[model samples]
Target: MFSKIDLKSDRFVVVFINDILIYSLDEYEHAEHLRIMLQTLRDNKCEFWLREVGFLGHIVLTNGIQVDPSKIFAVVN
Candidate 1:
């Protein structure tokens, strides 16, 4: 599925299994990138979860990506 959509990694999009993360420097670019991804997913007949989505156990937010505390603890222990 990822092969079908052409995106610059860590710039526009990142994919892992069924999970997909769409990102951009600003709102306008983010919207555009999201639209492209949604369209691609729709065309591919793939559905995405609006909630409960995370990348490598980390949450991607406007401020920055955060590692899950539980995951960190597990690694530390």
Candidate 2:
């Protein structure tokens, strides 16, 4: 499904089932990358929940991806 999108840049994009994580080193490229991703999803007739989406129990933010400490604890213990 992701093959349809051109992701050959320095940015990172990871897709899993209904979740997608788009990252870039800077803001301008990140916006462009996000636009491409959203367009692709719309073209494919896929619906996404913005508030519910996360990658491997981690949240993607401008600073970086953050994992829930509880989830890490569970894995460790």
Model 2 whole-model lDDT (C-alpha atoms) = 0.61
Give a tens-digit lDDT track for model 2, residues 30-71. 668777777666646543334433568776555566886667
Q: Which stretches of candidate 2 lie over 4 Å from their true place?
A: 1-11, 43-53, 64-66, 70-77
Give residue 33's error in model 1 in angstroms: 0.9
Best by lDDT: 1
Q: Estimate each model's TM-score.
A: 0.63, 0.52
- Report the Cα lDDT for candidate 1: 0.66
Please count the clashing residue pairs in each candidate, in the order shown: 0, 0
Query: What TM-score does prediction 2 earn?
Result: 0.52
